[model samples]
Target chain A: MSEKHLQTGDELPAFGGKLRLFAMRFCPYAERSILVLNAKKIPYDHVFINLDQKPEWIFTFSPKGTVPALEYEQGKGIFDSNIINYYLDEKYPEVPLQPTDPLRKAQDKMLVEQLTGAQSAYYTAAFSSPSLTPSMVETYHKGLEVLQKELEVRKTKFLHGDEPGLVDYTIWPFLERFQALPLLGKQEFAIDKSKYDVLTKYIEEMKNVPAVKSYCLAPETHAKYIESRAKGNPDYNMLDTSAVCCMRPRKKKE
Target chain B: MSEKHLQTGDELPAFGGKLRLFAMRFCPYAERSILVLNAKKIPYDHVFINLDQKPEWIFTFSPKGTVPALEYEQGKGIFDSNIINYYLDEKYPEVPLQPTDPLRKAQDKMLVEQLTGAQSAYYTAAFSSPSLTPSMVETYHKGLEVLQKELEVRKTKFLHGDEPGLVDYTIWPFLERFQALPLLGKQEFAIDKSKYDVLTKYIEEMKNVPAVKSYCLAPETHAKYIESRAKGNPDYNMLDTSAVCCMRPRKKKE
Candidate 1:
């Protein structure tokens, strides 16, 4: 897995006969599928793409060139995080992430729906500060409150019960990046310890989850990326240490 | 089931122990659930709501006051058409609407995603013609082309199969409403026979489906509703012949 973001004119790396995920490093939606794949312990190849200067090949996997497209078979792709994640859950069936109870599954979907307002608010606050409104800030807290209430009601170690499941993975990415808001000087977006004691504990527990631990970026790192993107020149390859590591002898500079 | 749209002051109808769906008669999303309920032969009560002046209890069923909220239990409600429909499909199990193959299921979802652009274009052309752009028209046609191509590739009577499935039900509501666009003076939105012979034939077949035949409104009726809505005074109860039919003697006007 190379951290380098492939852009225009880049040839897609040869399909390695494993599941391949097309993603952008900082995208939450993309992180969702990645988390699901990791939790399932599915062997996969991750190809990070530069969204701003997307590789032409991306359209083959995702018609809209969006992140989190899964190439399940050679050249055949499934797009949309939820669609891909659901497919993975069903196809593998080894580790079922969704609730078995149909009503419970619908409720889980609703919880995710409730959090969408907060996600939108986070986006506006982080990327379009000028458009941030008081109502959006209120919506953000409302989302957190909804999560806390659900956590208290369920009384489970995770939303899916003893083990983290699809619902948890789907939402964890948003929470991971939300921490960056306060660091970016948006103090209003802070998840206050007192108001969100249960949620805070849950967040910490999620951070320690084996599946989340490996891919979770620190709030400061997210803040740096957010700052770069907000300024228009998104540093897509800022975290690419592959350039620094001399794994093999390089050719002479062109 | 009453065709009259209940407004803010309307009393909450007594739950009949059957699955009760809160919907607005002409809303495509609401119609999606209705079609599913019919297809599954689920015993359900339908309560129509005035979206502009929503019943206070609508929020009890759907927090966002959106339509197609299902009261699966006496008081417990499940919102979102897809969530409700999927829940019904899983819970019932007698008539499974989804594909058995996981990849096929994902592909079905992707097809619905592709049709969204055309749905949006139809909305703009029908509701906000002033804002309609040439690119929107192009996107609308592109969505149709995608659908036609999928139909050709699959070679199925319905997007799902010989029997209409979730994919067919999900996409059909939009196609049903799309017919109204031409009558609403947007001829450019018409499904031309030459351009979409397969789609045209498919649409005709879908119309004949017993579930669709009972619930689907004629294009003229839809166009009338669209006109009323566009004029800012949506005749929510325009088809409420219950008012006209005096099953019992009525008191004279005071």
Candidate 2:
């Protein structure tokens, strides 16, 4: 429940005897696993870590100290957002997030792959605005177009049919963050209603999805984080208000 | 069965009513799929394409005109080597390349993810020698260490188990090509037996894998291809010996 990001030399939190996820607060890749956990309604503890000043112990969970590593067992861990999400889908199985059909699963993975270019463009427009080229802008729109076209073809409430599945969850984080570009003065990156009517509708619908609604941050907040990160001093603890916790509940004796 | 790569203006070959894969002769990514297909004993047709001057029809199969695109059902296609291979493993369930266990599958994927750094270093050392850095070299060795460490822990004949699985098939193409680095004058990239005893033994065993032995090219051959590719004019048709028809048998009347 704590939003605070632990940094270097930070003590490893005592194992609470539950599934634990090591992640950064604002990373989209990390957000992906968070959304999956919420969707699966799985009980898990979250340990937010500062990516810039990563805690030494983070490497124990992820070889490269990357976020979104799942402490599945007491000391064992699994890294990578897709790997974690897929494992969750298979391991839990009660609330399957992927299609039963293998071909459809593969197709879902391909659609996710198609969005890579758009993700690159979004990163450029967000943190390296000056280096944002015309081609990248084109790629940004191409990503939207691909989503829109797929939406038209599937004709489903969500890309995953009646409910958003792995493809939708995997991609929704990027869509969530892309909305912040225009807020950050990158008007060219906007997903206009005129050009992306289907995609825009889908975005609005995704915002209401229970899994996404809880963990999703507002575009303005994302823009602020982007600004800080772009300035070379990321406010990793922006959401940690323990210092000013006037309404904080007193801790019970353990 | 032509080793020839089809270029622009080349006619699309008859589909033969069998599964077909679009690929380049020397592309490692393409080779990954080829190995999987061979391992699974799946009946599929291979179409080698000139990557630099790709045939127009390639896009019909893969939007980016990239190789290892599978024409799964006549004209319908699936791109990305991983996607295609996973689909193959699932579609043709007779020979499952991936483990059924979700955790083990996740671990296999993570290992592949860890190899990305080494792959980048290999690319630089092979094609852009001037840009190769000390850190890149270190990263490459780190990749080897990761594999060796996994082998030590798993204590399996192959990364996949007694029989080589998806993990082995996916990583073997890179190991095969890594041998070419030393032959190309990048001696530092060698997988020294003294340092990588387990990996060296594993490499030899992988070379003997029926799926790999039938399709694997020698280090000298890969070095020749790398040389041609680095010079900016890839010899896409170097393996096409149709022009020298002295030993060719005359076609029978169809």
Candidate 3:
């Protein structure tokens, strides 16, 4: 009977019905949602929202009022990208995005959190300024260093060890953005692929995955989108690696 | 094949066997794991760890080396608190911790992430410092204001609409800590609980939940633990909230 409950009315379709993702192409969190969907191969509709002007429906569904919200008609809408990923994996149960081993799954989730929660903010801060500040650059480098050290020890093809898993999918898009930031002449925190061989190989392997390779928007497209944003023409529609990772439809070509 | 993987060895126990949680008592993230087990009525063994000097065995299992890790008999170890909670709900389907609806689940997860990832940090920074700098105070206030506004709009008995859900369990422990911090004379930020009647009432309601009430350590005991840490005792035995929340059999009954 409260306004929150009323607002959170059954907005998503019924369970097993079509899944719709309300996402921003550039949002790493949105990309995390996209990656899980892709891993599961769940076919869903994608609505790309403009960051400058989020769709009204998003505010209606998301109490936190952030993008990467999912609608699965089980009589309600799902708001978090990570939770949406879990729901899809649980409901679909075809190609599990998470490892079967409980502990490994937890490790994957933790790694993803580190990237999304901690490192992502540092990257955002470093990139948000018109010109990167020295401290921001230092923070960004520190984040990368932590990740680099972690990756060194694990040495898996992806973040979750071995084949591309949830953690890799969750983090790759954000790193992809960081990799491209140098295009904007902000290269101070650019990850030197040569220096971190394991990470370089991991990125390359991710690029080669069928779902990732086919569905991911080209780097050129993302560059163009960034350029468009900088030019004051804000409706940039190119999907980031995260969005591409999640939105890959499971059903094959007819 | 590596030493890390081989330590647990191949003969991992089945999923239904003993569940061991390595966690810190006061950590909100660890509280999430406890919440799931409490909700599901699952029995487990709790291992409290000193987070400051993490044991070698824990580091071997938890690659990221964070608390709220789980060691399941099935030769699995999970690191993130959220992932462990999800795994428990999935593995034990009898008492469902997640909502049936996907969207509601998403909302629950998002709120949890907001609490764990963002708001909790704000509260920690707010409560730990003697006097917050102007900028630090602003950030803390901003976070609280957002949470307060959201709570005002929601007006639910718990974080989820009708009943206590994942978010409530995951977040309440931190909120409890925040409330208790003022008593410690560590109040750097002000919280006007009066403005958000629902949140205030919800906290009161949470205190009465048998599962929550019975498992939570008494405020005085918890304060003692915090005091020891403040006094520069490095070898402190921190209670893992997971153990408390899960209502695991303790050596000494309260």
Candidate 4:
């Protein structure tokens, strides 16, 4: 894992002999693909970049310079969270995350699209935009209600039946971030446990899924990152571990 | 083909033995799927509904009362143009519009996403939106330039190949609708013959594709629809031919 924020003038990182993902520490979109990668147990290298001042090479991987771009080969890549995740699931089909039925697969994608309403509302709330309307808050609740209904109808431990699948991973990142809304002073955005009982339980279960558990962050951490980004100076290195040493100081011929 | 606008309290159209698609007369999104069905020579029926006054049963087919919902079974469906197209391409593999190569498939979807900039701009211009900005025009051109660049690099008669594929059909509708912009007084939206020689040629070829040729309307017709829609009264059933006789009023067939 490399947590370096390579800027416009920085050199491209040396290619590692594994699938590589260009990501930012705090992007929910990036986490969607990450969860899929972990769920499939695919061996890969994670390259974290600063979104605000992205390196030129990032565009080579992602045309829009967006995160969650996968460099499957030294110079070959693909971007877009859903596209990348679908590619990953198909290419590494040893553990398929998508449902086998075509209708089920379409429904999974629809669920992801439906959840984006709340995600958009979260974005507005996090960015502290003054234009965040009441309807936006309503949209947030409607999104949650849709998920709860789906949970009840599917009658599964996770949206993906016994375990989390593509649908679960695709929407989990947004749900994971939605928890930080109350901390951001957007109380209306918080999930009311009493109302969303099924969804609430599902969230708890997702946090325990090995794939998500391995990489998910707490609401406080997300809130802090949101605060910094809202102030126009995103703290992209909030989770950097590259600075840590091997517990031994450098010594000559030690 | 039924170009009738069934409103609330209207009966759901009886299931036709074959697959059915709920569409609107002038919707580009709906046309996307229609073209796919035609290109594949799939047996299906089309139900043209009035979007503004959607039938109560429309939700049974499409959750959001949106057009282009595919009624694959008696009471089951999958919404979203892309989702419907993917389902059709998968279920009816007799003619595969999608590339077998995963990377190429991803790129095809990405190109659709990329062209959305121009589509949004066209929407704004067609609606005569006050919010239309110079940046919107810039975005429209940027989208065109991107397509031009891709066409030049791919060196293919069509985006898919000599034969039009999913990418071509997916994008052709928007390109078809875009021609209506110049007629709507948005001259900036015009595809200058000299500036976009390649794209212009591609557009002409797509219009001639048998699948597209059968259903696509003239630019003047599209411009008229845009004008009516801009006036807040969309002439949805402008081309209604449901009342027309099979030929000479059945010529006293009885």
Candidate 5:
């Protein structure tokens, strides 16, 4: 529960007997795994690390020092959001996040792949405003249009189905954070009701999804973090849960 | 069946009632799908296309015009090697390339992801000789070391156990193509028998894999293609399967 980022030379945290996830407070990729874990209703501990000054030990969990990495056992972990999410779905099949149909599953993965360009577009718009161009905005809208078209074709409440599944959890994080763009004065990134009626409606419904609502950050929070990160200093410890939780990293009793 | 490169104005091939895969003759990513389909023993037709001058129809399959797109139906197709391979495994479960254990499957995916850095290094060394740096060579070896270590730890003949599975099929293409590096005068990219004894032995075993042996090309062939590709013109039709009976692309009877 501690948002205290372990930096270079920091010791690996003691094994707490629970599955652990290493994440950055504001990374959309990391948010993906968290959403899946929450939806699966699994008991796990999360450690938010400062990506700018990554802990040397983080590499033990994530080979590239990127997250979200899942420490499934003592001293053993696997990284990548899709990999972790798939593992969680397969290892704990109670909720079944992935589609049973083989073709549907493949299509789900493709949709996620298709959205990468839009993610790049968003990053440029939010962090490097000057580099933001008409084409980038076009790419961003193309991403939204792809999502809207998929939703229309699927005819489901969520892209997953009547209930949100892997596809839903995988994409929700970006959509959740895209809302922050408008807050950061990037109004072009806004999900307007008129043009994206169905998508905006879907977004409204996702905002209330129990799993999403529980740990979801406000758009304003994401905007603030974006500002900090753009300034070459990330506010990793913005959520200081030390005062309220037993899960906080505390000094050892001598 | 002809290894002919389709260009901008070529007509779309008629639906042949068999699953069709769009691929470049020398593209490693395309080879992943080809190997998987062969391993699965699925009767699929492959359409070799000139990636540089892609047939207009290729875009119908892959939005960005990449190879290894699978047309599962008459006109519908799904792109991305991983996506297509996963679909093949799940849809044709006769010989499952993917492991049933979720953890092992996730680990398999992670291994592929980890090797990507080395892949980039190989690309630069093979295609842009001047940009090749000592660090790129280090990355290339690090990938080999990572594989060798995994082989040792697994104590398995192949990454997928007794039989070559998806993991082997996925990574084999790159290892196959890596052989071309030494042939292309990039001797630094060679997998020496001394330093990479296990990997070399494993590579030897993979070369003999039934599915791989049928389509696997010699290092000389790969090197020749690399030479052409690096010069801005890929020898897409170097295979010249046109003379082979019943394999050449011919006009359908009107």
Candidate 6:
């Protein structure tokens, strides 16, 4: 068996020392978890996972074989980025990530689901395609349009109204990545910044935040990562649009 | 618009001032929220939603357009059964549905995701088909095999461990429905109880629980529901699977 295919057993790393976040730096889901940790000022270890060849330990703990798994002390491993954020909120009740209002909390979670489920597909289709197909572009635009409308309705400084909360932390990473992808000769899908004034302003505001800004990759670097994948480099563990994009745009017959 | 499609916007009848849970009796996701209410013994008005004609409020609040949704006193609606359950657990912390141990909590959430993402697909394909196809039956059995193996390894009374927790509540309702559909002759997917002794015992134990048993359709009634759907009744929302059986099996096709 390839060394890359080895499995990581379900054991938590020693804790009260440092919590390990197994993540891919460019993955929005992973980024969301990091944003929560940073926002809460929690100190921990960050293990940047190679998505192409996921460590066996990761698969052992997360049977779904996904990244952004958390290893807390006492040999407990938590999978799913959103659940991990919730864990942090519960474990560290101070500076809660979710809202106190039950209804608002529900909305926050629904919006996160939308980002992951609906909008993701559009971004994925655009990024994975060898050349930007018209269908892929349209899908990306539709996703952005939906996001733009939702942001308009919220009319908040961030996704969850006023201060950045779980919703904002969860979505911004993807939105930023979507915008960054255009530098790789992927045509900039018109976002109509004026249509989503709140989102545009929120993006600017998020960039100013020390933690978000610190982790934010320069556009050129991100494009380089995409370029490497397009070149079919075997060692490419970089962000492949296929991994991140959830929406699969219908392919047209050649 | 049909009267059934319109929302009165009026408050639904409440039990102890808690809003009603309008859901299909057999939906596992719906059961998750209901389990929370049952575990807490929280009084709630139970309004069974007809899957054939979903209420407009349900579609408006639930973006995915599935159940179970909750209507609060202030016209605030919560959608997505899992998110709604989280709202309930957080707002009514007196009887917590989630485990306090971070590791156990993570495992609980992961198990719930697996049930929804992996296992549920089999039930969806099998039960949703107009006629049970061999391929659908194969898919259903494959899902059951994975579930059986997982149960064997854990050997817990509930999905998480000894006591029933969130994952058990989330999955049990769906499994109940999946098992019942075959008895109706709508499908003929086999699940050998002997192969999964723990799961067999678990299902029996679940059946005896007053809350679970009370909500479950009498075997005769559930059989009727399945038969009605098979007859192409417009009122039946379950998928017809008759065409599936005519198709070749997966291994042969490959």
Residues A3-121, candidate 1, lDDT per residue (tens digit)? 89999999999999999999999999999999999999998999999999999999999999999999999998999999999999999989889999998999899999999999999
Tens-place lDDT per residue, model 2, B136-199, is: 9999999999999999999999999999999999999999999999998899999999899999
Give the per-residue Cα lDDT of candidate 6 at A94. 74
Better of 5 and 6 by TM-score: 5
- Computed on alpha carbons, the lDDT of every model, listed in order, comes to 0.93, 0.93, 0.62, 0.88, 0.90, 0.64
* Worst window of 10 by summed lDDT in candidate 6 chain A: A1-10
Q: Pick the candidate with the highest DockQ.
A: 1
lDDT for each residue of candidate 4 in A71-183, tens digit (9 for 90 to 100): 99898788899999988888888999988887888898888778777888899999866879999999999999999999999999999899899999989999999999899
DockQ of 6: 0.47
lDDT (tens digit, per residue) of candidate 6 on A1-254: 00121223423233455777777766678888888888888888766656665566676546666878777764457888988998887787777767778767877777666555434543453456645466656656666666667777877767765677777788777777766565655555534577656667777888887768767877676567656655655333443454344696534423
lDDT of 3 by residue, B36-73 (tens): 78777888766656566565667645656687878876
Candidate RMSDs in Å, in order, are: 2.0, 1.6, 10.5, 3.0, 2.6, 11.5
Native contact fraction, candidates in order: 0.97, 0.91, 0.59, 0.68, 1.00, 0.74
State the DockQ of every prediction.
Answer: 0.94, 0.89, 0.33, 0.71, 0.89, 0.47
Q: Residue-wise lDDT of candidate 2 within A23-102, one digit each (tens)?
A: 99999999999999999999999999999888999898899999899999988899999999999999999888999787
Error of 1 at A101 (Å): 0.5
* Docking level of model 1: high
Candidate 1 lDDT, tens digit per residue, B104-161? 9999999999989999998898888899999999999999999999999999899999
Q: Per-residue lDDT of B38-63 in model 4, one digit per residue for the tens? A: 99999999888877887888888777
Ranking by lDDT: 1, 2, 5, 4, 6, 3
Give residue B165's error in model 5 in angstroms: 0.1
Q: Which candidate is the best by lDDT?
A: 1
TM-score of 6: 0.74
Full-model lDDT, candidate 3 = 0.62
> Chain A TM-score per candidate?
0.97, 0.97, 0.75, 0.95, 0.93, 0.77
lDDT of 2 at B40: 95
